[model samples]
Target: MRFSAGFSRAAAIAGLVGFGVLIWAAVISPARDWATSNKVALQTSRVEAARLDASIQRLEQEKAALGIETEFSDIWQARQIGEATAKVQAELGEIARAEGISLRSIAPLQSPDIPFAQAVAFRVEAEATLDRVVALTSAVEFHSPVLIIDRASLRRLTRPGRISPQPTLLMQLEIMAPVFIGEGEP
Candidate 1:
């Protein structure tokens, strides 16, 4: 009887040990591994998000440095092609006058086909000193609403048998500007 009772006690202890091992393998171990994997994934996501945020900030700073406007209000907008061309002419005349340029002719040229905007072009003939011409070109290039000096022809005027200081130049400039049509208009 003593031997049987000892054997029974040993069997019960072995059963409890087996049960503990089963619980640890089937439930606790898998749960712990799942938690670890989730933590790792969360950390990785945070790192990626931080990297994206930094990139966005860098791009925004670059945009600001380049003087790029976020709104389209600064762009030239007109309801008609004639209006756009007139505005371009007026602006060019003003700049030329300010730079002491004598405009011989200012004529509107046919615009090229552009998507979502109309290109307003002009053929401008002017007489000015070299310095004034350079200043005029610079002003047009840096003008708000954006102006492009597509083509420029400069000729130095010389008098026969007379040498004059600061020779005058004949400047023919082809300037272009993009004009956006207003909403609900063709």
Candidate 2:
């Protein structure tokens, strides 16, 4: 039997179309899906890297601030224990005089043994009004050198014959000054 030319041509065209569809299903479709997933992963990684960079900048700023505070504290440190105590006493006397407070006594106490530094303590007794005492305490706190008020006591003074308008208070303060030991010192 002889086949028609039109029928053979149509069969060949259908075979070519079927082969093209098979190749697309086997290779090209899976490759396209993989490329799409990799693009999404790249975007996510970029976002994470930006967030980490911002956090690093913030930490650096905090470290710089801490360094400045440390330097400021170091500038106020004293070298010798006895000299620090005497200087603290003189400063207290000056503050009392300026605030119109009468300083009864200023005596040094036993120094405390601290690591890398010595703490020189003092017992200060003064008589003044409440306002004057408050002013004196403020002066000590805001002074250039670092002065710590370890303990404070205020009591009303009683007089037998003399009746005054404003009551006088006896203020007792325990102040500490830190003296840093240098490398060259013994």
- For all predicted structures, in order, the TM-scores are 0.58, 0.55
Q: Rate the local accuracy (lDDT) of all candidates.
A: 0.86, 0.78
* Stretches of model 2 off by over 4 angstroms after superposition: 1-69, 72-75, 113-116, 183-186
Write the residue-wise lDDT of candidate 2 on 1-186 in tens digits: 246677777778887887888888888888888889999999999999999999999999988876673433532344565666667778878888999887899999888665545778889998888788889999887776677788999999998997877788999999877666444432
lDDT of 1 by residue, 28-63 (tens): 999999999999999999999999999999999987
Q: What's each prediction's clash count?
A: 0, 0
- Candidate 1: RMSD to truth: 8.7
Best by TM-score: 1
**True lDDT of residue 186, candidate 2:** 27
